[model samples]
Target: MDNRVLYERLGGVFAIAAVVDDFIDRVLSSPALNANPLVREAHHRVAPAGFKYLVTEQLCHAAGGPQRYTGRDMKTSHAELRISEDEWQAFLDLLKQSLDKFRVPLREQGEIFAIVQSTQTDIVV
Candidate 1:
């Protein structure tokens, strides 16, 4: 097993957390995402900082970092949102924008995207 992990490649927890913070901010404020009544309501209900923390934990865990995700499962959290394909694509675009802003390497971006893609079925109702 290659001892190297994606977490280290991503500059560890702090870096991942930074990216998550930016991504969450973008998602929470995106007009496209908020256009959906359910999404808008949930976005307004959840605390952005707490949402960022959970996303950071999930990302760190997915990248093989020490942190464990304490948030709800993707299906449970997103099922009620009823996200459309367009909204899902918009979310992905925002993630890519965030990754680009951080100058994430292509390989790391691909790995991160794969991890995110794995949850698509659960998230996109």
Candidate 2:
């Protein structure tokens, strides 16, 4: 059996960061996501590079990498955004686009989606 952690399967920090970069850029530029004024403001308020760094760290940690995420909890971080179910789905769709663009294997994508799904309750209002 392939026993590699999701982080290893995903090619470690460099590969994870590359995907985060693309995903964040897509999120930042998406009018659908930005339709929520709070999301739009938050996207513009934070430096793109720093946001990407945190996401990479978070994903790496969640994927069982050596990196530890130093960011705030999902609930606290997203508390004020007031995201809806549709917006959340839109976000997931963008993530899927990123994974597909990178040609991430199906198993790895499923693992990543599971990680993302765990945060949905905290993120969606």
Candidate 3:
């Protein structure tokens, strides 16, 4: 029985970073997410490259890669935004689009979805 981690299965940090880049771009441009003033302000204030770097680190860590995420935790980072269920759903939709664009396998996508979903309680108000 093989026991390869999700990070290896997904082709490691580079692949994960590519997905994160697209996902972050989609999220930053989302009208639904930016509708919240707090979200809008943060999106505009943060440099896109830095945002992508943090997100890539986080995703790599979550996917069981060697990278350690140095950014703020999910709750602290998102708390002020007052994210709603609708916005969260929109974010997930964007994630799905990004994964689909990269042709991530269904099994891997499910694993990634579970990892992201684990943060739902912290992210959604």
Cα error, residue 69 of model 3, in Å, equals 0.8
Best by lDDT: 2
- Residue 86 of model 3 has an lDDT of 97
Better of 1 and 2 by TM-score: 2
User: Any runs in candidate 3 off by more than 4 Å, and if so which?
Assistant: none
Ranking by TM-score: 2, 1, 3
TM-score of 3: 0.96
Q: Which of 1 and 2 is ahead in lDDT?
A: 2
| Quality of model 2 by C-alpha lDDT | 0.96
Candidate 2 residue spans exceeding 4 A from truth:
none
> Best TM-score goes to which candidate?
2
Model 2, 3-115: lDDT tens per residue? 99999999999999999999999999999999999999998999999999999999999999999999999999999999999999999999999999999999999999999
| Tens digits of lDDT, candidate 1, 7-88 | 9999999899899999999999999999999999999999999999999999999999999999899999998999999999
Model 2 earns a TM-score of: 0.98
Give the winner by lDDT: 1 or 3.
1
TM-score of each: 0.96, 0.98, 0.96
